[model samples]
Target: MITYNPKDWFTFIFRFHKADTLRQLAPLIIGISVYCWIVAFLELNVFRLSENSHVKNITAMHTLLSFVISMLLVFRTNTAYDRWWEGRKLWGSLVNNSRNLAIKLNAILGHEEAAHRSFFKKIIPMYASVLSHHLHAETTRLALDEHEHPELKNLDTNRHMPNQVASMMFQRVNRLYEEGKIKGDQLIVLNSELQSFTDIMGACERIKNTPIPFSYSVFLKKFIFFYVMTLPFSFVISLGYIAIPVVAFIFYVLASLELIAEEIEDPFGGDENDLPMIKMASNIKKHVAEILN
Candidate 1:
């Protein structure tokens, strides 16, 4: 994610980055401006649509549609941010649950079960790393010390990596139980943390797989496109050459909102507006290791 100090108001307002919507919207803004200029010149010099009563009706239509678009954009952005926040919360749960599992393992098994305790602690961060990569559909070949986790090198890449890692965790819990390393009462507590692992994984999967409905998104795009394209005709009739910048600014506002909503809708991606999954997962690893160490 792009990080910068908001030194002054001007810098913050004009700050440009790869994730900024202006890069994508610039071409469209220019097209809209040129179209507005043409319409203004034609209506004033040749066709004289500016004085027509129809222009007033069109402007009135735009005024109403602008309100509707504003409301729709609000809902879109809110929904996107909700998904983003949900992903962050799920990661937070992963961190907390992992820490809880580690603490309990250390308390229950302690130095006597050092080898087994180390297994779960090491794999905990592996799950987080693979889960982050899984959401982004990237390959995860995270290096692991073979002595710590023998199965780490053998885990099947064909299967869901997070689920596989969780399965290994559950298997270790069962082995400990079979050997009478932990009592049933302690087993119940550890199993609960194990379940939490699955729960967090499921929650992140839901947010990653599900997206804004196609119909709603498409309709909004089409509506906004028509609205922005026709906007300059009426605007130019009223404001002449000045309407170019005015309509361009309007296009920028409307398009920027849609672009931002799109960017944030998928919070798992590596975009600036997306959740910092890499850093978050690393932090989880570091903290869990510190606890176990």
Candidate 2:
């Protein structure tokens, strides 16, 4: 995601180039211009329908339609933002819970033996980092070269990648129990932490798999196109030549907003506004290192 500080609005807007924005908006601009020309030709010559009374009625209808469209846009944007924010919040909880689990594990197992303490310290962060890597694979590949873990290199499985990593962690936890480093109760507590990781993973998966319905998206696109096509005819008599660019700009803003909502709706993807899973993993490494040392 674009990490904009509160004071960086000027810089943010100046350099704001999302390639998807151009891809979505280009066709919209072309369609609107072509539509305006067609409407202008018909209104001026063939129909001669650019009278004041006709314009007034069309303007009233456009106003009502614009209000309804604005409401739809607002609802769509709000829903997308909620999904984005919730994903971030869930990850935030994962970070906190991981740290808490590490601390608890240390308290329970640290006193048993220095070797066990070191092992738990090393493994907790590794587990969190692996989880982060798994979550981001759909969006971007994990930079294994930069954050190389010998343990991760050895992992090979045909099953789901994240689940495999979780299984590895569980096996390690079981080993700790079998070694008599942790009591039965401590094992139960560790299992709870692992369960939290599983829950977060499931939540992210749900968001990734479930999308806004295809019908709603199709309807929204069609409505926007039809609305822009009809706009110039409504304004040709009143605004004359000025109606062209005016209608184009209005369509541009509405289309851009819709494009942004779509991009952020699945914030786990490789979009400009997607969650920074790599950065989060790095932070997890740092925090884990601090605790270990």
Candidate 3:
């Protein structure tokens, strides 16, 4: 995500970040301006409609519909933000669980068990890295170590990567339990964190797979389009040429909100506003290595 100082209002206003909706909206803004100008001209010069004309009543309709549209946009934005925040929370849980698992394994395993230490250290973080790739629909190759462990090499990239990784961790932990490496109580303690890896993965998958309802999304776009297109009809009578900029600004505000909602709703993607999955995965790797090593 694009990080910035929230306190720096002037910088935010003056600088157009790469993901700024203004860039995407610029061409549409110009088109709307030109369209508004034509509408204003036709209404004023050609139709010669007066303020008392029935056409001017459209402004009242807009005033009432503005409340409705604002409510819809508020719901839309909030819903999208909730998904983004939930994704972040799930990843946060993954980070905490990974750390807990590594810490537990460190305490339970003998200091001489370098192989087990190496496996847990690499595999815990590998879960996060693999989940990140899984959500983005990329190959789970980046997380693979140069000297990959023999057990991890059996992972079928064609299958669900996060599940395979989780299964591997569980199998290894179970083996440790069977071998009397970890006691019954220690197994129970480790179970929660190990299971949480899959839980977190499932939650992330829900967010990545399900999207905002298609009809609702389509209706919102159409609502904005029709609402903005009709603005000149409402304002042109009294405002004349000035209505062009007024309508354009309104469209800009409404359209920008939709654009932001769209970008953030899928927090796993490459959008600048998306959750920092790669960085989080790297942090998990670093922290797990620190704990296990």
Candidate 4:
């Protein structure tokens, strides 16, 4: 959601304010640093256990752990990015379908038909907004004013506002068909759009409901934790006081990867890297109105 000129890469990097990773991972990083420091201090100064530390051989595990952890992190990031990309694609499809539906409706009924134009202009975008809010698990969010969309009162009460809004679209199309405003091939086209609306919503719902498996996530976290935790043991003996920062950096990399994966795995939510649902819906509303204009 952080928008800026791509040409100004330096300013973009320096000034981007969405500190999502730092906000979440800073505490864990600090805790890991503190833990590493404590272990180093005790081993180097107080106990001197690191001087004769037999566990220096544990550094050998780092080769295999490093490879496994890298592969795991790669898998985790890819899985999350796949979900995020799919969400973006779905929203893109919704945008196209809404525009197509709007254009087809306007063309068929004549743009001078104020009631018909208004219905498509308002309702299609409203469906997007409602679906966006619904996917974020937010209730009581209305994109259209009651004066414009009196159905929100009924929609508010429905368990699934997006589907209800889509149903409303269907009813409107059916009305157009019965009144002969859009029948035959035109009806088929409109019905296809309606079906696309439903199908897109269903696809978004599937992504929202399903997630990266919990056990897989837990195992990765545990794997990274135990592996990085053993870093100080191997390191304090060799690096002396420098092991704290080294372990901390290692912890930062490993922990940040997991945190990032968690954040993006559910890309429907309002994260920095999430599909900008509200903005997309709002743009849909803007474009719909512009088309009618």
Which numbered prediction scores highest in TM-score against the true structure? 3
lDDT (0-100) at residue 54 of candidate 3?
93
Q: Which number leads on lDDT?
A: 3
- By the lDDT metric, which is better: model 2 or model 4? 4
Candidate 1 lDDT by residue in tens digits, 53-136: 477568889888889998999999999989988888888888888788888887887677678767766788888888899999
Estimate candidate 1's alpha-carbon lDDT, on a 0 to 1 scale: 0.84
Per-candidate TM equals 0.95, 0.85, 0.97, 0.91
Which residue pairs does candidate 2 place in steric collision? Answer: none
Superposition error at 251 for model 2 (Å): 0.8
Model 4 Cα lDDT, one tens digit per residue, 61-167: 99778998899899999999888888889999999998988788777887567877877788889889888888989774665666775765676445878778888
Write candidate 2's Cα lDDT for 43-94 as tens digits. Answer: 7777776465556477777888999899989988998999899889878887
lDDT score for residue 289 of model 4? 88
RMSD of model 4, in Å? 2.3
Error (Å) of candidate 4 at residue 14 is 5.4
After superposition on all CA atoms, what RMSD does each candidate show versus the true structure? Answer: 1.7, 3.5, 1.2, 2.3
Q: Which 10 successive residues of model 2 have the least lDDT summed?
A: 139-148
Query: What ranges in model 1 sit over 4 Å off?
Result: 2-8, 50-53
